[model samples]
Target: MHDPGSSEHNNRIPKPLGEAFLSLLERDQRRMLRICTRLESIADGLPGSGKLRRTAREIAFLDRAFDRHMFIHEKFLFPLVRSLCDSRESVEPMLCQLEAEHATDQGLILEITAAYAGAIGSTPRAVGVPLCTLGYLLRAFFENFRRHAAWEKMLLHPVVKDQFISETPKHQHDAVLRYSIGAGRSGRWFPAVVG
Candidate 1:
């Protein structure tokens, strides 16, 4: 068995897949940061800022993106981790919490969307509750998502790396081949060329 502590086993998703996944996550983080920063600016000032409509569109788009991202994790990453984890107990609760966050995010997005619309149509006082709620949720969502990504990096990645490393040389090579061919990115199918 390969040692979990081995540096070679410190990266999950194989090299190519991991790199791609990290890039995607980083891009998503940038989006979240932009949303968070935009949200923060409104908290201190009146929503009369001309940016409400644009920011509303971005938040709406993020709502859909979050759903798709969560679906990807649920369909691919989390299952892989669950199958490979040394103990399901160690990872299950975290997965559950993260999944639950998706629902919470949906609700927050609704509130934010409504707030944006209200602020645009009428006075800030008319939507004070939603405005306040939106500001709070933005900070909460960004921080929680940042921490969630960190947990995957620190905890799940190590476990996945260790599991991948534990495979026989042939299997590791096959995994790389499969991953490189887009198996990890999406459920694409072709005969896996095995030598």
Candidate 2:
């Protein structure tokens, strides 16, 4: 096991893929934080009945951010980490847990969107539901993201660097860059690539 606190660990340089992945994660985290701040401000105003449309638009933006996170983890990050690990025994469980969390988050987003839409369509009863849902979802979203980011920065990143130095080829490094920086260019929006 790597000692996360040691000076050696602190001095270690991340592999290209690991660095790119961290950069993407950091960028998205900042973006989400900004969005959350705006949402909090909006929530403070009590968001009158007339503002349902705007609230719905904000919820849609949240959905987009959440979806981008899922794409990165499910499509790129998790797979690469799993492939490089010696045993799936431990990592698989964490991946499963994280994926389940993603599913729950997506479900909450759908619920909130539906409520927001209903409210916008003039059903006053539906308005409160989205506000309550967003409150819960935001808490879960931020907590999960914070924990995951710390774990990656403290544990997985160093391990990935060690593994990459030991096993990866030059072409694989280039491939990592392409996947991290170049994938999903046209209509598909990547949170990291977007802002």
Candidate 3:
């Protein structure tokens, strides 16, 4: 495969643009994992549906942060790499896989959310739906997503960054916005949750 950002290549992204974007995206992912891990630990022990309900609500509150983080990547980062990439053979498939994973992740989250909601509310057990299903879905999502995110960061990020840096940074338009939690703003950088 052609190396876009290698010293032997001309298509390398401007180092600052690629690294800057990659760093913040990584940060957002790490923070989100921390939150999710904490929530998982909360729900992992004991057998109380009430605890599940509370945990669901807590996770729901932070769902937007996760959605927004993915949105920015899908909407901005991947497209740039796709269009500018020289070795489409190598990276395009990966980007497509990433996008597909994004969709899969969305579906998994919805399933998890529904299962949690079912566990929380006074639903009919006569329908044969077990509350244990919720626990299963919750655990599945965390286990799966952790590996997926880690793969993206480890394998995909460097390649994308190299491609992004090869291009002249000024001409491209990325709708970059930070995800601030409180009295702050994302502005030109990636999103941040302050709270």
Candidate 4:
């Protein structure tokens, strides 16, 4: 068994499948950051900037991307972590907490979508509560999401890296397919290459 805290384990690269999983997650997060920056600018210029339509569109995109990202975590990453770590007692709490956060995020997204759905026209007053709520909601989601992603990366990556370090390439590929395709049931969304 690999000692997760050992310096050697910390320095080792994750096995190919684990590395690929982390890379996909990191890519999604970077994309999210770009969208968050864009949303922040829109929020800064809110209320009467005639960006209502654009805000709606951006929020929609964020909603979809965020939903998919969270699905990958809840369905794939968390379970994989649970199976990989010998000390489930150490990791289970974090997974549960993150899952709760995912629920909260979904609720927030619904509220945001509802707010923007009713919002119409370019005037500040016409936009009403949505105009008032939009900036705060966007900030809340983006801030929480950024923190959550960073926390997950910090806590989980080391375990994944250490656990897979000694796994053979064939074993790695089979494991990836087992978790990411057969069990995750999300192969359509993110197809795993058998090779």
Per-structure clash totals for the candidates: 0, 0, 13, 0
Error of 4 at 24 (Å): 0.9
lDDT of all the models against the reference?
0.60, 0.61, 0.63, 0.71
Better of 1 and 4 by lDDT: 4
After TM-score superposition, the amount by which residue 67's alpha carbon in candidate 4 deviates from its true location, in angstroms, is 1.5
Candidate 2 regions exceeding 4 Å error are: 1-15, 49-54, 122-195
**Residue-wise C-alpha lDDT for candidate 3, range 86-166, written one tens digit per residue:** 455787678778777777777877776666555555445433335677667667777777887888888788776665565
lDDT per residue (tens digit) for residues 1-195 in model 4: 988999998899764875677688779878878887887787678676324567778888988988888877776777776555556699888888888888887887887776665455444544555666777777787787778768777876666767666576666676666655534323323233211
Q: Judging by TM-score against the true structure, name the best candidate.
A: 4
Error of 1 at 86 (Å): 4.4
Comparing candidate 1 with candidate 2, which one achieves the higher lDDT? 2
Which runs of model 3 end up more than 4 angstroms from their true locations?
1-16, 49-54, 122-129, 164-195
> Which sequence of candidate numbers ranks them by lDDT, best first?
4, 3, 2, 1
Q: Model 3 — TM-score against the truth?
A: 0.68
- Candidate 3: worst-modelled 10 consecutive residues by lDDT: 177-186
The true-versus-predicted C-alpha distance at residue 180 of model 3, in Å, is 23
Candidates in order, TM-scores: namely 0.60, 0.61, 0.68, 0.73
Error of 1 at 60 (Å): 2.0
